[model samples]
Target: MDATQQEILERLNASGKGTVLEALDISVVEATKEKVVASMPISSKHLQLVGYLHGGVSVVLAETVASLASVMNIDTARQMAFGLEINANHLRPKRDGQLFAVATPIHMGRTTHVWDVRISDEKEKLICISRCTVAVVDRPPDDGDPLFKK
Candidate 1:
């Protein structure tokens, strides 16, 4: 990882609004200015009722990868980026083996950021594709919420 990439991952590890991918042990396979790749093994813990990888799991992986991209976009500015919208479509169901996701930035601007996330399996077959938009804010949205847990 380059100095800038390492700096971004450092902040992501310290972030509070963490990914659901953590439960699956998603590993960062590649990280660069061009694209980011993350992977995880498909195990029973990640499966649903029929012994197939849960569709929701794929969505989480896609979103998490995109979230990482968004975080990297704002690390230098110390700004918070929160997903404003996400659209996902599942093309295939992954039953076993490993799943990987690649996230690339479509647009990175001052106020809004967009990312294209593609999730595939061991054979490099597309399982899910998603688009996420994050809004860059000066502070987290919890500003007006109660300090105590609800």
Candidate 2:
């Protein structure tokens, strides 16, 4: 990881958001300038009544991983990353197993970044895939403001 990426990762690791994400067994495995890989375990809450994973859960997980990747490159006050778009394709069903979501940078430009995220099982078969776009923008100052928590 580069210095800037490391700094952002440090901030995220110490931030409140990371703490909550961890409680859900979600974490980033690879974080760098143009790439990020996050993993999450599938649980009962993530499944449908038939015991298969819900489509929405996969989409949320994919979006979260891609967004976190973008956030790692954002400055807390000066700039932030927001999702511009997200698209996911579900290829198969995951009955019961630990699934991982990997996000790879597809495109990184001056104003936007795109990530390709894949959800896979222990067998390495892709269960779902997502393409996410995040827009980099100048963020307003926190200034001890309650609107955006510290």
Candidate 3:
């Protein structure tokens, strides 16, 4: 990765520190305008009643990476991205190890971005396939609120 890409990766990883991503141990390993990748390790906290990876975990990973990728394609100073829609199909069950989600763009337009996110196990076995649509909207004029500062 180039300096800029490395910077983005580090920023994204750090941004997770106080969010659900941190709670789920998700970290962005790769990031670029064309693609983004994140990984989450499976543990008891991530499993369902049957002890398999929960479908919701896969969906979270899918949307996180897709939304992050969409953010990269927009003008952060003037625009923001939000997940408009997301669909995931779980193809396999995993009990342990790590899950990697790779997100690549299917369509990038002025108002929206569509991302294809695939989740796979350590050995490259596909676990889930997901598609996410993100809407890019102009940033509302920043109020003095700290939450809107950045």
The candidate maximizing lDDT is 3
What lDDT does each candidate get? 0.75, 0.74, 0.88
lDDT of 1: 0.75
State the lDDT at 29 in candidate 3.
94
Query: Tens digit of lDDT per residue, candidate 1, span 57-128?
Result: 877788777766776666544466677888889898877899889999999889888899999888999988
For each candidate, give its TM-score against the true structure.
0.78, 0.78, 0.91
Q: What is candidate 3's lDDT per residue for 1-150, written digit by digit as tens? A: 234777778777876778889989999999889999999999999999989999998999999999999887877767878899999999988999999999999999999999999999999999999999999988789623222244
Clashing pairs in 2: none
Task: Please estimate how well model 2 matches the true structure, expressed as its whole-model Cα lDDT.
Answer: 0.74
Question: How many residue pairs clash in each candidate at the backbone level?
Answer: 0, 0, 0
* Candidates, ranked, TM-score: 3, 1, 2
Angstrom error of the Cα, residue 15, model 2: value is: 3.3
